[model samples]
Target: MNLKDKAKLLPQSPGIYIMRDSLNNIIYVGKSKNLRKRVYSYFIKSNNVTSKVEKLMKNIKDFQYICTDTELEALLLECTFIKYIKPQYNRLMKNYERYVYIQIDIEDQYPIIKLSSEIIEDNSLYYGPFINYNRIFKFLEGLNEILPLIKCNNYLKEKITCINYAMGKCEGPCIKNVSSKEYKKHINKVINFFHGEKDLIKELEKFMKEYSETLEFEKAKIFKDYIDVFNSVFKEYKHILRLNNYNKFIIIDYIKNSIFKVIFINNHNIEYVDTINMNNMDKKDLEEYFKNIYFKFYLINNKESKNIVTKEFIDYVHIIFSY
Candidate 1:
């Protein structure tokens, strides 16, 4: 049978479909609650199909699927397959290690703002899996100017003050001009700022106004740049902050055909996944089941491994978090 005829034989169930070229190499992996509908859609021609999809479809010589109990399982399985297979058609979240973040080394006696490419298990605070490096870099640069936190990498080694300290832009922690306690207070403000509790933008605007009123055009321009970066990035940053807050929680989702899925999350990693059939249990039994699983997993505090953000895991997180 041809690929189109073969797709028609697929079951209408939650599963992932693997598409292959004539060379019998798996080129793409996709999932759907209804395997037949999704697989069939790819075979049928449409003018609205994207160039990428058109190219992918043209190369498809055959396909197959792995049946899953729930859509969540299908999603997770798709992430795993794509990560291991490294299919050419699968693009997004593939290079997750390249994702950027704003790191605050809170473990240090004097914390400083720095950009990081990955998240690790440490005492430091991380602010993103931000995609745009230039934008985040600009925002961090502006933030360093607005906040009197440390700026130099040599702050721990050098006993003397730097250019930023001389210009009153740094608290001079390296020279003992600011105590760790006082400097950390500034770090707390930055933490609150990312959590959407503090208004750093308002302060930047205030400084901009003051410089403008005093006719210090050069200084005013600097503050204006900071305010502009904040305005552009803060909204998305707030959304990211909320997404990151999906730590240590349980997600119960009802799948079709009387199936319910329970996901145990800890520090953005899925600790466990289980499914129960509503048809098999009564109300009291369901309640007892939930209670058992809840107490079994919820009360315990588990530390995420240092290398928590795997490519597959990141895609899985995005799928469930968005759901």
Candidate 2:
């Protein structure tokens, strides 16, 4: 069938639409709440569409859709296909290599907080797959200022001291002024802060207020920017941690009166999608289905590590986390 003819066959439901070129190679993958309306829009010529979308339409020779019970299911499936297929026009979430993480090598005598694009097997702790490199860099800069952690690279080097030490800003690990055991306390506080235990926001706010009262406007503004960056990034950091704690969970999305969309997530992976027609099933049958899912998936595939966010699935998790 022709492209327009195929589009007319799509149902009025939430789903992912795959656009293909004349060569039958997938070029674009997109999700929408209404498949028929969304797909049909492509055929209905509109000048308002972006140059990118117009370009995408020019290459499209065929299209297919996977019908979903709910928009959420469509979103999950769309991410799966985009990640695996790496479609030509699917731009977002494709550049996982550019995602930056705040790294801390606790294995070092004096660990330095640094931004890393790649996660290795080295025993360091990695905190993010954050997209904003400049924001993270600023947040870490302000964080090191408040925490008295080493901000200099001269640590364990032959250099006696740096300006940070002269101003009593760092604990002075380079000069052995603070032993590894003592300096670790600061790192532990940072770890606690990342874990959502330490209330650094309040403390930073206090410093901001103090600087403002003393007429140190520049310093106050500096702390203000720190707080801004912290607020933007830390919430997502905590969210990833919470999500990684779940090895398996079921998201039951109510589509209508008697239809439900069931998504089974295991180990940051969407394992299965099941649609249920509750028009015939009784309460007891519904309860049994949930119980079976809980026991079969949740109990058997419990999360092993609460803190570890694997670098491999960080981008995948980002897609779900954003949704």
Candidate 3:
């Protein structure tokens, strides 16, 4: 249909509108507050792209739309539809479908834990869709550190706790040193941690106070450690502007298995161009995290080996802590 003909049929509601070419192929998927206004904006002379859109518009014949409840809904629906169709000319907006998040099935009878891009179970809660493996590993590690979660088994009652708990690294929930109810409470703390609410600090303080009053100094210390972790983590790293470098180059790298990301600052703007591998550190060490994560991500992405991640290089990354 012609522009004038198409304008009359468009609605005033929020929705996703698809523009088609002469061959009836979807060229673009767009969303807006008002379908009519959005579609009209595309038809205007200035709205036409000087380069690619010129060719697309010349081949345009008809279009389609799906109505949504609200503008934000329209925007979300548009993104979903775009991912589904992956229309041409929207190359920059191509979907990020690679990352998967670790979800804890808290509401289930056995609580099946797994990695997922989207949580399909309405019964369970999703912890993250973390794009980085290092982050995911830290999350699982942190979860294990504070909570009574069983990392080795699906069902808590299946078997006895592992050697970690025997060595004081765990709380021994698998053999029932901790109850399901208490485990659930720890899971709630994990939820609070993920939320990263300011009130979480307050709640942590309150919980610490209660534990101290009850003479549970060990438990209070655990909470204090976690609080310190949150503080140090928030302070040492950031994504926004920084004073470390004039270039303020941000190095964002993700490890493959977990939701780990490290934001490093450098005077140089170079990225994946230079490899700063840091993969030798063990999983339990907190000090070597940034190095371990960066190295694994670098190696995984580039298909390199640990020999490339030298001890001297690890020391260099550690020096940044002093800076």
Per-model CA lDDT versus the true structure: 0.79, 0.82, 0.56
Best by TM-score: 2
Residues 14-115, model 2: lDDT tens digits: 999999899999999999999998999998887799989999989998888899778887887887788788899988756656778888999988888888
Tell me which of candidates 2 and 3 scores higher on lDDT: 2
Model 2: lDDT of residue 278: 96
Candidate 1, residues 1-323, lDDT tens digits: the string is: 98888889999989999998989999999989999999999878788999999999889988889998778778878888887888889886466666687889888887888888777778888876665578888888877777897777788899888888878898788879888998888888888877776488888989899999999999999989888878767765654545455456777778778888887877666678888888999999988987887777765544553433433355566676677
Give the per-residue Cα lDDT of candidate 3 at 105: 80
Q: Give candidate 1's error at residue 213 in angstroms.
A: 10
The residue-by-residue lDDT of candidate 3 on 88-173, one tens digit each, is 86753343454445577877533535666664637666543334444555545544554445566543555766777776765666
lDDT at residue 260 of model 1 (Cα atoms): 84
Error of 2 at 62 (Å): 3.3
State in Å the error of residue 316, model 2. Answer: 4.0
- In model 1, the worst 10-residue window by lDDT is 303-312
TM-score of each: 0.72, 0.86, 0.35
